[model samples]
Target: MVEAARILFGEHGFHGTGMAQIADASGIRVGQIYRDFESKEDIIAAMVAADLSDFLDEAVLAQAIAMGDRQRVRRWVLDLMIRKQQPNDSTLLPEILAEASRNPRVAAIMREGDQRIRRHVAAALAMLAPHAESACARCVEELMMTLMMGGCSRRMALVEGDWQFLEGCMARFLDQQIAWLADHDDGAAAADHADA
Candidate 1:
């Protein structure tokens, strides 16, 4: 049902899609669909949760951290920042965002997902810069999030080649920031040791 809704929502805006359309696409009965999902907002929430699970994959980050592999963690962070959007996602996300603006429940769901993302980004940043101020890490987190969302929006608006060029530029920018954070943290540690 969720997959069906994702397709429908991508083709048509959130308001344009109906339960019957989802049921038809999924080959499920409308009654069963309603029984499973309280409302369209619930379905959207589920979609957001699923995407978050796939995107964050916290186990990967946790394992890297546990292994004390700074380079591995750095690579994971860069991968997260520059993930490519699926063709479906390119359209579906904008529809979700448009609905979120009008529906408080949808907006709340999006907010919760955003918070989860922020926490994950913060953890990655901490690995890069253990001594960095929380405020500084947060600034970087916001910048990364903005770049990600802007990339999605650009994909939705532009042709493939146009966005790919901008994407490469953003990826390079994120790579540089990650490298600087790691270097800065190493420098700070050296200074502290020298003082000791």
Candidate 2:
């Protein structure tokens, strides 16, 4: 049923697709879907959750862990914004966002997912900039993430190659972050003072 739903959902936006089409594609009796899922919305939510779980867990987080502090934070965010574009990865969240523009329920779900990703970004930044609290680090991380996201999309629209402009932007952004940290690195300052 889900396989059918995936195809139908992918082909048409969530609101445009119907359960009958899903049943037809699945070659299962339409009622069987009900036995498995309560409603179309339920199936949509389930499909979205299932599709996102693997990319978010494996490709995204694993990539972040392998990266350095600034790269980890940038990649952590880039992963969220582009995880859908990954080959063989589902674009469910983007679809959900589109659906949410008209659907309060879907909008709420996407908002919740957005919040989770924001927290994950905050955590990644905290790992990179441990001298700063989560709140402080997240402010910077969110700004960079938003910049990368908007920049990548615009760059992709104008460019034809697989561009990894993130590293250069991150380096520049990190330089700024480092300068700020140098001036306010209480931990390092305290250690220096203690050593003195």
Candidate 1 per-residue lDDT, tens place, 1-196, comes to: 9999999999988989999999999999999999999999999999999999898878999998889888788767766766767769878988899889999999999999999988888888787777664555677889988877776676677555654566577668867776666655645766988999
Candidate that scores best on lDDT: 1
**Model 2: runs farther than 4 Å from truth?**
58-94, 133-135, 144-162, 166-196
- TM for every model, in the order presented, reads 0.85, 0.67
lDDT of 2 by residue, 1-196 (tens): 7767766776686777887888888998888888988777777677656755754564555566566546655555555544435331244445655777887776676666656656666666555666764445656767856764565454434445444555555556665764564455558667888999
Error of 2 at 18 (Å): 0.9
Clashes of each: 0, 0
